[model samples]
Target: DSQKEANGLRTDHWVMDKRHSTYLFFMGVGEYAIVKDKWKNIAVDYYIEKEYEPYAKQIYGNTPEMIEFFSKKLGYDYPWAKYAQISGRDYVSGAMENTTATLHGSDILQKPGQLIDENKWEDTIAHELFHHWFGDLVTAESWSNLTVNESFANYSEYLWNEYKYGKDQADYHQMEDVNHYIHNPSDFKKDLVRFDYASREDVFDLVTYQKGGGILHMLRNYLGDDAFFAGMNDYLKTYEYKNAEAHQLRLSFEKVSGKDLNWFFNQWYFGSGHPKLNYSYTFEPVKKQVTVIVNQSQELPFEFPLTIDVYDNGKPKRQQVWVNAAAKNTFSFDVSKNPDLVNINADGILVADITETKTPEQNLMQFTGSKEFKSRYSALTAIKDQVGKNPAATKLLSAALKDPYFRVRQKALELMDLSNADQLKALGADVEKLASNDPKTLVQGAAIAALAKTKDKKYLSVFEKGVNAVSNSVKANSVAAVLAVDPSKANTLADKIDLEGASDELLSQMLPIIVKNKVTSEMSNIAPLVAFYPFLKFQNPELGKSAEEGYNWIMTSDNLKATESVTKILGQAKGQMGENPQVKMMISQMLKDGLTKKMELLKQNPQKASSINPQIDAINKAIENFK
Candidate 1:
């Protein structure tokens, strides 16, 4: 490690040297392997050349299948000869589908408990892989055409996920993120153009991926699968080996579907906004039945599904609808002679804000409607949103807690606000239930946090059981989540949780979960966290101050080379000021780190300095201040 800092060598550099050119390359190295060495067919010893091992293994593992999967699916064969991808340790954005390489945030990878769930990390792998055909094989012409690259991958991920793990799994991911994005179409938080603006990583915003996928889904539903696939095939066939503008795609799709999609595409993609669909329902006592009205919200008018729920005397009567873009629309399903209530967006389709005007008994009919996972998932979410006033939401939330898909359960974990005692206890019970039923890494972590979130003393045993005998990531996520809820117990559990043989990355991830727990504020609140984990030392004034900005060069004291020159500023330099210990350390590290980062950037194209600017300025300032 010390020699690596002085030599200006890093893993990414070795990978670039392996790759013939910079045009089709972007490299990242981290521990977010969904299933480490799951691709052993192409596994090369990352230790032989060591730094070049990850990119090489990635290239080797996905080479044949990833290439073949698209060739047949896209109605075309592989365009690029090679593909590579990696994950960053702190990358917050979803995942980047760089030309030949896909870069994901390090947060996604887990050793069982670090994250809320694992399906996402797995799906991320598949999703980016699908992009091998969509975004990468067929490049988007401009930034505006980002949906072309993203939506296809998003929908493809759903399609492939369903193909791989049933529709239930896909629905959990799509319906949550995509539907959320649709509901708040203009929610810039999930920016579609996570590309041009913000930071390089910020391009992984929710808009393009989630809403982009949602819009594709709407288009798929609108065009029907046959037409959709035909259009997709034609889109790629026509635009393959070249760039495609959004208008070009809209025109081609129109040709394929024989239906003008100007309105649909503009409302959802081109425009920077969401449409509102209004839903209203009333019981017509005079007519001896109930009446429900569903329409788009004046704000947020992105077209999607609108499923209505009917109840006769408050008993759920099955009824579903596919509401397209209509300002004022009404559809009457059979109702009992004395229907008592009506629910619009009963299926929670169509992007809109729904106001509930019914009881849980009445809502339960919709809540547990048809036992369909998607609807049940939505109803559970609805219950969670109203957990404060509606006690029945607990049961609905409980049902969601038992959802089959790890992803759905993950959402239930995120959505359920653990404020009330009953709700909190319910949350803890659900986590424990999952801990027993679903032993996977992601779900286990979510369960740990949910149980911990309760902060209920009675739930300590559950936390103890879940926290004990888990992976570093899982234990970290669980311990962190638990600490957030009940720090005292979390501390006790932490003391019991082992960190032996854990990596620095895992330690960094787990330490935060142990320290600064939101559940309590006192050192006593986080005593266990402060005790067991050594990465907690990052919170130390020395390392904390140095690593505050997250610039790889600054923190490592080597731009991208892994040097530790920042030691000079602290008077640890062995020579005079610039030639002094601190300066020498910084220079040694910077030259090495710079060579790695700058070389990678240069390979990507030195013309775009912004790519390396974040690193460059970060390094310059870290050293410039020393002078």
Candidate 2:
């Protein structure tokens, strides 16, 4: 209770069993407003800052539902006396699962409309909450086996997404995770359960969080739903409040499936990298068969068990085959007729980078007729590489624009050509429709941004509507689109942006537009030039480039006052911008160019150049001092 006692102060004491690790224990006391709720018989407390007290419902109100969902799903009850979450303004990471108490970053405390984009963090909450079971209760035996905890917690994000949203949402998240791991320059072949380490912190990478989660997801798919969940329940029951290694998890699944998981565990957990494959298929009409040749080109080979689907006359015939660890592997399937298309890894059973050498006609069959989302995605990628004015590619992309999956539509929009008016005229209706009516905010944002590439005025109305979108990304894209269609209106659109609350992304996009329109005078009234001028040293290359252009425009303006403002910003940012070579080079070039222009004017009108000598000398001094 918050009531004061005879001691002139209120005291609240809470305790939990000593089953959790030392790192899992947490406590905090401050001027906080406690929001209370319940799940079954367990009490839940959401401790939030007094300023964010009213938003407690929007931030942590769903704790009970998540607890109930996880409890029922894991075949376990709430393990602690009370489940409490505290929103800390100074918290570093997203959130930490501390036995009975979880600490959330202040980003979770959103007010009213802020919940529109901010509520997308429900997955993060789900991730930390799942650690209560995977990390707090059944912990990793050592830092080397961190994947045992982080991977399972990451997988829980997909589980909740699949359970509440749908398989499509879960699949999208899986693909995103795969993309992050694959695109990283680091080696993917490291063993997830190895003792080799640089430090404990090295285990907290994408390999442990994303790639590990992906492997677990694949294992679940391989074991089937019933067996997988049964094995998980057994694993949790056996290791409650205890630390476990990766092999123990393998043993649990092996016991449930009654099969040796040596190939699965050794290749995935102990293996270093995913497969990089190049494949081609041949259809022999006389023999009525399809032959697929796959080549493994990575440092180490991977054994891939994949489903191959052959499409003939719009009908799919599925076959499963294993590709051994060989440089070259071949598989032939007997069919009644020549196959129109062949899909390898149609079920997405393996994580690998696959390239297909198929004709547009063959790919269109999978693009339009394949039942599996992976098959369709692969077909889209194959066709996306060959995107052009080709009628077949255009038709396939147009068809893909209407796909039920947002990712497919997003990819199509990305690959679609809007280089000229004719192309936009052909695909404009679909693109405009998606920009205006797509249910997914990301897809709509992509469509809206694609308009900026066209630079055609026909889609001005679409861009105008998108400017008021709920998503900041969509709004940023809309601003660019408006400027592209009508450069004169950049200042008007930029003026409406809430510069104080604007995200770096929105500011980055708007900055370039404002520079191109030469609207420094209009922007100076909204926000101080110095506040944005330092973006010349921004970490993002694009933001730095835009800021450089903005700086150059202000320096080159005919208005002497604007040019003087540039000098002041350069002076203010001298020491900070010195470390960045790009910013220094840009400033050096601008000063050199400005000094040359002033000298040229001096040859024509000696009196004006004499009057501007002080400004010229200052520019020269700033350039000389460039680090």
RMSD of each: 11.9, 8.0
lDDT by residue (448-539, candidate 1, tens digit) is 65665556666555555555554554655555555565656544554544443343444444544433322222212222222222232345
For model 2, residues 229-262, the per-residue Cα lDDT tens digits are: 8888888899998999889998889898897888
Best by TM-score: 2
Q: What's the C-alpha lDDT at position 61 in model 1?
A: 43
Which runs of model 1 end up more than 4 angstroms from their true locations?
Answer: 1-72, 86-120, 179-207, 270-272, 285-289, 295-305, 313-327, 338-343, 346-349, 353-358, 370-374, 385-391, 407-433, 440-465, 472-627
Question: Candidate 1: lDDT of 491?
Answer: 44
lDDT of 2: 0.75
Tell me the lDDT of model 1 at 178. 61
